[model samples]
Target: TEADPLADAVAAAVAEANEPQPSAPTGPPLPGGEKDAFRVAVGQCWNVGSLSTDALGTTVVVAVAMQETGVPDGGSIRMLSFSGGSEAAALQAFEAARRAIIRCGARGFPLPVEKFSQWRDIEMTFNPEGMQFR
Candidate 1:
């Protein structure tokens, strides 16, 4: 039997429609800023200097939740995931990130309110090897 191009096209269209669509940004995103600056700001607010060299290679993903008024939930910093290094290292990294949140203060996270919507539920991956935002 010959191929049915119409059937193929219909199937493709249906498949595309069924595919999960990316969610729209909850709020406007902030204009591009230096990620390094953001990292430095957080680093300054917390102390993670005691971790051993091995732990320094770990990366932890931290999620911060914000409220409607642009205020972050006081205890919303959560360890979503991690990569590289041992479990202990990952735990240390997670704690460090949390401490940064606590110490930095949600309202002073170095992000403008203009970007609050986008970051209301943002996850930040912190790599300890170089303190870079991945």
Candidate 2:
């Protein structure tokens, strides 16, 4: 009887441990209503078409580090990762992502100042295939 009780407790513990747990949010979700704002801000500043006509189906992950002052450090914006249709496409993706930062960074991302703390670091995926952010 004692062994049966012990086995049941062990089984229950194992099941509890195996139960799925929600993942922690990687970075702050763009505040409500700011999604469009962020998109527009990046789009207006992004000019990578000339950089890579071959980057038709490429995606680049850009990481932006937000300072407490609501401004991104000059060297904080960088390419975290990328995927492309080809080797050349991958290069183009990086170029395009870099250019976006150079052009749009001077004015700082259009992120709301109040929410800067939430997005201390933002890893955004730029998908040129659909010209959308993921």
* Best by the lDDT measure: 1
TM-score of candidate 1 against the unseen true structure: 0.66
Ten residues in sequence with the least summed lDDT for candidate 1: 21-30
Where does model 1 exceed 4 Å of error? Answer: 1-23, 34-37, 68-71, 132-134
Per-residue alpha-carbon lDDT of candidate 2 for residues 1-134, written as tens digits (9 for 90 to 100): 24688888999999989876534333456666786666667666666557556676778778877665545565877777767667678677767766675676666666656655456777767787556444
The sequence of per-residue lDDT tens digits that candidate 1 reaches over residues 1-134 is: 99899999999999999886545464555655644566577766656577767668888888888665545576777888888888888888788878777666666555656655566676777776566343
Instruction: Please report how far candidate 1 places residue 93 from its true position, in Å.
Output: 1.2
The local distance difference test score of each candidate is: 0.71, 0.67
TM-score for each candidate, following the candidate numbering: 0.66, 0.62
Cα error, candidate 2, residue 9 (Å): 33
